[model samples]
Structure formats: structure tokens, C-alpha cells
Target: MPTSLNDWLRILENRMLYLSSEAAEQVRLSAKEGKCEGLPLRVAALVQEDGSFHYAIGFEDTPKDEDVRFSDKGVDLIVAPASAGNTGRSMYPFEEIDPATLASWLEKGESVRLIDVRSPAEYAQGIIEGGELMPLHLIPLQMPEAKEGEKLVIYCRTGMRSGQACGFLSQQGKDGALNLRGGIVAWAQQGLPISRADKDVSVG
Candidate 1:
């Protein structure tokens, strides 16, 4: 629930690698037994072209520029931007923003383009405030005319479709399109403001 992009990235850095205290202690002991005792632990996940994921964990003397660096339970952890799509098979250059940051953007009067990648029926049931209905299937066609400098954020019911949409936009050489992590479900769960129309009666 971070209100800014930097805060959101910091949260992601800490949560991306769930190193328990026991695990950290084990790593520390293992490192001490080995010659490279003080080296920092680097954890990375990559999505392959065949819709598969690969993960790596090891000690590194230096961190990459794009790596999100932080500590969890006394264990140093680093995550690269390439690992954003680790939860799925598709990999692209888009980023993920949390609901609180999106809310903060709106509250600060920032010009952000919010696109709802859900179906019309689903959108009618409930939608994030200021989100325009832009079904996932039509993103390729409609996104061509998007403003160059606008920050575009897409979301679906549970973030699956929106992630795909973000990947598609990234592939098209578009910049500044981000997926809303956990989608509108996460948004409402955080008590963020949403808009519901009378056309739908079901809860998504």
C-alpha cells in the first residue's frame, strides 16, 4: 500500500524474495563455511520464450544497475526488472504499480490514463474510479492512438488480462504502460475508491 512509485518499488524489493529468518541464518552459515563469506545474495527470475520461468540464487560481488536491491530478514536480495513477469510466462518491459500509488496519482491530479481491460459486463459490475473500459482484445487496435506522454495503467478483475495487455503494449514499442498489480480486486481490498453501475448485479 505504498503511495508513491519509489515506495511501491521498495515494497516489491522486500517482498519479491521471501527469505525467512531461519533461511537467512542458514545462508549466513553456508556463506561462512564457503570462502566468499561477505558476498551479497542475488536472486533473479527470468521468463523464457517457451512460456517457462527460470530462477537463480547465488552470491554476487556487485549488483546490476536495474536490480532492485533490499534486505529481507538480514539477507540481501536483488531483483531485476526482467523478473516482473515471473508469476507468468510472458515477459515484457512494462512495470507493475500497486493500487495505492494509482490512488495517489489521481489524488495528486496527475494525468494518468486508466484502462479497464475487463469485459463490459464485468466492468459494469464495478470499476476503479476514472478507469475507462478497454477490453483486453481491443487493446492492440485502440492503443495505437494513445498519447505519447501519458502514463497508461491497465487493470482487470484479477490482473491476468491486464498483465497480458501490458505485455502487448510493450511489444508494440509503446512506453509507460503499467499493469495494476492484483487488479481491481486488490484495489477494492485495499479500500480504494471504485465506481459501480446499476447494469450489473454480480460480484467479481
Candidate 2:
């Protein structure tokens, strides 16, 4: 006698393969009670370009030009379509800048805005004194229109949030919003001076 439908489903799951509930049921019902046929299931296995398994899922048909995955021992990730190619627009590689560069730009009285995207409490701890406060959560609503060709610099506590803010600004027609690489932490870590809010506890 063949295994039951439930048993086959369990086997597929145990193997880390995927199957929709409906599809699994169809295979179960079509198989003989005691015996079973290996149903021809279509699947797209997203394997690394090198040769490691990233993820696999059963599909009805083959997809066109799947994303390439790296197979080397280095960090591997599923590169999204928007950031796949070498010259893709979504690829905004970070450009390292020192505190002196920032100070020089400010000294020259350049028409630039330092936008901060950290939380209120984090911002109060220590931030660029003249930087504009625009928390990440309010970027959608509080964002003001950017003038054409305006220069803007965005920063957050550790550079992560500010980078996201820069991306958001980029989408909002602010192409000049450069994210402060390494953020305030990088600035202070380099022995640069900092400014703190007088009422620190009020920020939270």
C-alpha cells in the first residue's frame, strides 16, 4: 500500500520544498491509497550563482532571467532586480568623507542642509548642532519640497537610518541629499567635537 496523502505532504515539507495547500491536496487525492506516483511538480530553486541553495519554491513554470546568487565563501545575498547590474541606478555606494570635508563645506557657506533622521531621544544625545531634525517616521509627511540642484547631507546615529533617509530624499526629487557615511558615530569616533541638546531628557 502507498503512504497516505498526509504522509506525502509531510515528506515534502521535511525536504524543505514548498507546495501550495491546494496543489498538495490535488497530489494527495490523485495518488492511489496505498501506492503513490511522484507527481511532476514544477519549481524554481533560487540557488546561489556559485552553487549554494538560497531558497526553493514550487512554481507552475520557469521564470525569466532569475536573480544571480553568489556561490563563493564570501557573504551571499539575493540581489534585487533594481540593484542587479553594475551600473544600476539603485546602487548608491557609500563615499567615505571626513569631518574636515564636512567642516570645509560648511565654512565655505555652501547652501547645504544637514538632515538628521534619528529618533528624538537619540538626536538629543549628540547631533550636528545646525542639522535639521527630520525623524525617519515623519519623512513622508514632514518632508519639504527640495529646490532644484540643492545640496543636502543626511545623517543618523550610526549611518544606517540616515542612509535610508537619503534614499527617501532621492525618491522625493532631492538628488543631492548625500548620506553622511558612518553617521555621527563615525564623526565623533574620529575625535570630532559634538553638540548636545540642553534639555536632553525632554526628547524622549
Candidate 3:
């Protein structure tokens, strides 16, 4: 076990895991919003049979016996043993923008890459207007090279998969990427417009 934050970071470095500043801020904000301030943020990842990865982020009040605990940029983090061993090259912060804010940006004609990180079937079922299809698992392979001043907004059926996509993009140094909070579910709940096949429907 590590003795202090420094020791923990050193261990993570050796294992090819890292924490980003933005991710640390998200951890802090998540805890505050959950009314569980001071709790550590837990991160776990696993590789699927097809080589894609799945990740989870949540808050924990206490560390488990098998957890690797550490703090960086004032954010406490816990890495599950299984995930720690299976982690990929790196991990980055998960940032999000509310549905209404995203809609407003589009309405204002702001330059943003509205990406639907869902399966083709799901995308065909319904998607935000102007959202391009880019499945979650294919993000790392399909995302274009990061460029300054470019904004990438990713969404899924719910916010879960898009959060993973944001993390993956952040790992590649795509700091401008943001996940659509609540995903299309929230957007539809807000009565926003979505495209179903070739038809445009207003949930509102």
C-alpha cells in the first residue's frame, strides 16, 4: 500500500495510470453535487472481449481493502484492483455540458462537433439534429486529431457512454471534448428536437 499522495501517484505512474486536472475538478464537483463532499472518487475500467474498454466513476466514503487510494489536485481518487490492472495507456477528465446549453450553442451557430456516440441502430432511432454518428467504442479510432479552438460535443442514449467517450478523448489530449449531460434522454425530457430517421420531431 502507498503511504501518501506522492507515493500513490508514483505507483500509478509506474502502472501507466494518470489523473488529469479537469478530471480532478469533476470529482470535486460530483462529490459536492452528491452531498458527499470529501468522499473519494472511485474509478474502474475493464476491457471487453472485443478489446473495447468500459469505465466507471463514482464516489466512495471509505476505501476498500483492495483499493488503491490517492489524491491529486485536491481530489481524492480510488482505483479498484481489477481496473487498475486492466487500465489502458492513460485516463483523463470527464467534462459535461447540460442539454439546454448545448442546444443554445447550436442555435447560436457556434462551431461545435455534435457527435452521437451510440450504435447505428440507436442513432437511426433518434438523434439530436446535426449530430454525427460515432459509436462509443470507435471513438479512439475515429476521432480526428486534436486541434486548437475546436469543440467536440459527444452524446449517447444516456450520459453514461458519452462520459466514457469524453474520458477516452481526454486521454488522447482532446481537452476541448465535452459530454452531453443526461444524453439524449435528458434532451428529449427537456422537450428538445430530435431527428428520427428523416423526420424531425419536437419532444417539447
Candidate 4:
């Protein structure tokens, strides 16, 4: 019954919140603290074009009729379709590697897999050499092609988004995925080389 996009959003946000039993329990505790009892929780992805996620989460006392329903460990939730994501919590390890270490690897000609989780606009400005541009939204689709035992090092403008990507990867059971500490900002500040993405030749 929505007539416009914003109206549609008033009715829904296409995303999923997958919480493990432990994570669900933690959420339960947090909800208790927020005093959001008896109200269904909603997790909205206030994402930006640069593949950064800004979540707007809280209780929804009156969910729209068309809103998708999901329940985990007695914590009711309202979301949209799957594909929109958040792997609530990870049971695997996550770590960040400083810029110096990553630069050293590239200098030594080590076969390090570099994934750039940045928007094309941002990527066009510059990128780490040989880095694959797999924006946050595309990870679920592109990550499957990753090789076994691949040494993946993900990065962004700052360390934050890469850390999120690493955590998401960890949730997928891909162990040993490393985040570039301080991200490209640190790498550039350290005088490590950055390649300008050729709009014509960049991987589609």
C-alpha cells in the first residue's frame, strides 16, 4: 500500500539479523537494559554508498503488516528479505595487521590476497595494488570464489569497515582472515604505494 520509496521504507528495510544462541542471549540482555521488553526488535541498515554500515536498531511496537518476521531464542525481530546482512556474532577469531606488515608482505612479493571494501567512487581515487574491489554489499556474493588457505587481507579508508568485514568473514567460518589496521589511510601515511584504479580496466 506504500506509494513512494520512503513510504516503502517506513514499512520495511531489507535486511537480516542472524544471531547465534550466545549472541541471542547477549541481545536479550542488552534489550533488557534498554527496557525494550515485549516489543519486537528491528535492525535497520543505515548503510552508505561507500559500503559502510550505520545500523539503527531499537524496539518496534507496531510493525507494518508487510514486515518480515523472524524470531531467535524468543527475541522477536522485524526485518526484510535475506541478503541484507548482519552475522550477529562470530564464533571464530578476528585480528588486524598493521600497515607495516602488509607493506612488507607486498614488498617481499608474498601472495597476499588484498580485498578493498570501498565504493567505486572511493576506489577511483586510489587503491592498493592488486587489491580486489569487493564492496561490503558484494562480499556475500564475491567471497565464495576465494581460494582455500588464501591469505586474505581486507581494508578500507579506515580500519572500521575492514574490521566489520573480517568479523563477517569469521562468522562464515573463514578463519585467519586479517584486517589491515588503520586501513589504507595508514598505508598511505606510511608512504606505501597506492595505485589509481583505471576506470576502463578496473575489474567489473
Candidate 1: global Cα-lDDT?
0.66
* Candidate 1: tens digits of C-alpha lDDT, residues 1-204: 233345445655566446545456656754675455877766445545663333334566566576777777777766654343442222354567888889998899888888887778888887887778877667877883357667788988766567667767776777567778778888999998878754643332
In model 2, the Cα lDDT at residue 171 comes to 51
lDDT (C-alpha, whole model) for all candidates = 0.66, 0.50, 0.66, 0.64
Number of backbone-clashing residue pairs for each candidate, in the order shown:
0, 5, 1, 0
Candidate 1 residue spans exceeding 4 A from truth:
1-90, 144-149, 197-204
lDDT of 4 at 122: 81
User: Candidate 2: lDDT over CA atoms?
Assistant: 0.50
TM-score of 3: 0.55
Clashing pairs in 2: 1-34, 2-34, 2-35, 49-69, 50-71
On residues 89-123, what C-alpha lDDT tens digit does candidate 2 reach at each position? Answer: 33233222446678678778876677777777777
Candidate 1 matches the true fold with a TM-score of 0.54
Clashing pairs in 4: none
Report model 2's TM-score to 2 decimal places.
Answer: 0.51
For candidate 3, write residues 1-204 as lDDT tens digits. Answer: 232345444655565345555455645654565577967767664544554334545565556576677776787777764332433333355557788889899888877878787777778798898887777656778874335655788888767667867876767666667778778988999999987654432211
Q: lDDT tens string, model 4, 86-116? A: 4233112355678898988888887788888
lDDT, residue 142, model 4: 68
